[model samples]
Target: MKKQSFHIDGAKVTVYLDGPAWDGKPSATLGAFSCKTMQSGTSVLAQAISFVRDQGLNQIIGPMDGDTWHSYRFVTQTDGSPSFLLEPGNTPDALEVFKKAGFTEISGYFSARVPVVKTALTTPTATTDFTIEAWNGTHPEALFDQVFNLSTQAFARNAFFKPITRDDFMAMYMPMVPMLKPELIFFARQPDQTLAGFLFGTPNYAEGPKPTSAILKTYASLSKGAGQHLAHAFHKAAAAEGYETAIHALIHDDNLSAIRSASEGADIFRRYGLFGLKLNG
Candidate 1:
C-alpha cells in the first residue's frame, strides 16, 4: 500500500491507493478502484481530480480501475451473485461524498445477472440477413476493424464527454483482444464487405470474487437474435467449462433501445453511482 494525500492539507480526509499483486501498470489501476466505502480515499479522489484538472482533463469518468473499460464495475455487487461477477468496490455513502465534494452523476450504468434460459426474443434479431463467419489470423485484421467501427457507431453516444481516441482503446482493451474468442466473436458483413453489426463477448479473467462474467455485447445494424445466438454459445462454453455466472455491465438507463433489450436481462445487483464535479477555476 503506497499511501499519499493531496489538496486537503490538514483535513481529516485522506485517500489510500492500493495495488493488488496482480496488476502491472499506471496510477489509474493503482488507485481509484474500490467497491467498499471504507476503502475509498477522500484525499486520493481529491488529488487525482486535481491532477486531471491541472493536466487539462476536463472530464473524468470512472469507478474504473484504470482506463480500460472492461476492467471493473462501479456498482456494489450483491452477495447472491457469484463473486466473479463483482466489480470495482462501491459504497452507497460514496455517492453523497462525491455530491458533497462536487461530483454529479453524469450517467447511471446498470449491471444484473440473468439465468441462461432460452433465447426467447420474439422479434427477429436485426442481423438475420447477413452471413456470419469466424475470425482467424489468416483473415484480415481489417475485418475486425470493421466490427470495431460498427461497435463504435452503436455505442457512439453512451456517456462519452469527449471523443475517446483510438490510442486509448489500443492502450486499454486491445491488449486483451488476442485472448478473445475467435469463433464466438461474430461479424455480419454484406457481400460488399459492409459491416452491419457485431456480437462481441469473451471469457472474463480479472481480479475479483467471481470465476467468470457473462457481460456480452450486440453492436450493429443487424439482428439482435444473431447476437443472442452467439452469446448463448459463450454462456454454454462458460458453464461447460465449470464457470458459474455472468454480469451485464454498463447498461445506460437513458438509452431506451438498450432498456428494452435489457427488460429480460438480469436482476440488477446495484446501480453504479457516478458523480461529476466541475471545479471553480
Candidate 2:
C-alpha cells in the first residue's frame, strides 16, 4: 500500500494507492483511494490522479479502500432517508469531485428496507439432506471460521473478490458478538452437521436509542433456497420480537440477493457506487 498527497492554494488531497491483485492475480491497477479533499476541489483530485499515473499505474479503481474488505464506495443517491449502521456516508461534493476528475461508476450497490410485519412467516423447507438451526452465541472463533470457509467458496465469484484470512474475518466481526441477537443469526446444515448456509442480522443501534429496526448484515449459501429460508426465519423472528422494520444492507446491483430482497417486499432506499478512472499512464 502507498500513500500520496498534494497541496495547492491551501487545498490538500490525500490518496492511497493500496490496490492488491484481484482474485489473486497481479495487475497494473492501483486503487485511487482514501481520497480526502479539504473541500470540493477538482484540482486536488486531478493532481492525485496524475501522481498515480506518473508512477506508471494504468487504471485506478476506487473510492475503494484498497479492496471490498474495507470501506469503499460513495453514497450516490438516497430516497432521502436516514442512514443505517455501517452505511457509507459521503457528501454531494465528493461525488462531484470524482466526476470532475473523470471517474465513472464501475459498480453499484444498494440498501433496502421493509416492514418486518410484511415479511411472510412461511419457512423454506430444507432439501432432504439439510437442516436449519439458529446461531447461538458460542465459540465465536469456531463459528466465524466456518463462516470464513463458506464465504471463500460462496463469494468466490463476487466482484473484486480476494481471499481474506479467517483471522481478518474474525477481527472484522467478533466485536459485534455482544450485540448479536441469537434469533437473528442462523445456519443451514447438511446431514453431516456442516454448515451450508448462514444469515447474520443485528438490531439497528445506529439510531441512538434502543432500536426497533434490524439490519440483515451478511449471508451466504451453498445451496438453492437456503438464503431465502434464512431470511424468512430471521424476518419472522425479528417481527415476533417487535422489530418494526428490517433493512437489507449493501447488496451489489448484480447479486441475486436483490431479487430476494424485493420478493420479500423490501424497498430500495439507498444507493452507493464505486468508481474507476482510467489514467493516461
Candidate 3:
C-alpha cells in the first residue's frame, strides 16, 4: 500500500481524509494525531495546515482531520469524564501549537441525539420562554449573515476566537444550503425581534438508513436561556422535518457555552474531534 508520510525531527506524522466533497472543495476534515512533544508536534501540525491551505481549502477548523465542522476536539482529562474539561494531559499544549501556527477558534457547536421513541423530542417545552422561528425564503444571504453575526457575538467569549472572515463563512455554508433544508433551521428570537440564537438539522426520513443528507450543522446565538429554549425549539423543528435521530455536529471541549448547552438537552450525541491551532495574529 503506497502511503505518504511527513516527518519532523525524530517524529513520524500522518495525514487522513476528512470527508466528502462539493464542487471539488473539502466539505469537512479531521487531521490524525501522533505527536511526541511541543516542538515536533507544532512542526507537524504547521506543515499539515499549510498543506491544506495550499490545496485551496477555504476555511480550516479542527482538532479535526479535515475542515471546520467535524472530528475535532481537545481532551482535558483522563478521568474519562470531561465534565468541566477534566484537566487532561497535553491537550492544552496541542492547541497552543496550532495557535502558534495561525489558526483561530471561530464558532463552537454541539451534539445532542433525540431518540426516535422520544416522540415529544421535537415539541418545545411549555416552560420555554423564547420565540422560535424559521427562515422561509430563498437563499437569504441576510439571514446567513445574521446567523454569522449573532453566533460570532455569542462565541466571542471563546478563548481562541478568530473572527471568521465573511468570505470564509459563506464558502462553508453556501454549499450546504440546499442540503441543509432551511425549513428545519430554527432561530431563537427575543422580544425585541433580534436573533438571539438558532438550531439547524437535516432529517434522514428517506426509506433507507442513510441520512437524508450529510451531517446537519446547527448555529445559534448564545444568550440567557438560549441553550435550553433554543434546543427545544430546534428539536421541534427537526422532528417536523422527520429526522430519526438528531446529530449535534461539531463541538469543542474548551467552549464553555456549548458545554452548558449540552447539559440542558436530554439526548446529546457526538460525531468527532479536530486538531486546533492558534494563529499569531
Q: What does candidate 3 score on TM?
A: 0.54
Which candidate achieves the best TM-score against the true structure? Answer: 2
lDDT of 1 at 122: 32
Worst 10 residues of 2 by lDDT: 26-35
Q: Cα lDDT for residue 196, model 3? A: 77
Model 3 lDDT on a 0 to 1 scale = 0.52
| Best of the two (2, 3) by lDDT | 2
Show the lowest summed lDDT stretch of 10 residues, model 3: 79-88
For residues 40-87, write the lDDT of model 3, one tens digit per residue: 887876676566555545444555434333234654223232221111
lDDT of each: 0.49, 0.77, 0.52
The residue-by-residue lDDT of candidate 1 on 1-281, one tens digit each, is 23433433322222223322111222222234322343344555666666655654354444444333444334533554433322555455554445555666655666666654422223344443665655554443465556556656665444432234555655555565665666546565666767765656555555344434555543344544445444555455445555555455555677543554466556677566554445556
Candidate 2 positional error at 33, Å: 6.6
lDDT of 2 by residue, 19-108 (tens): 645434332232333335535366666777777777666577767655677777888889888888887787677777778777889789
Runs of candidate 1 with Cα error greater than 4 angstroms are 1-40, 47-73, 76-86, 90-96, 120-129, 134-144, 164-168, 205-213, 217-246
Tell me each candidate's TM-score: 0.62, 0.88, 0.54
Error of 1 at 85 (Å): 6.5
- Model 1 deviation from native, Cα RMSD in Å: 7.9
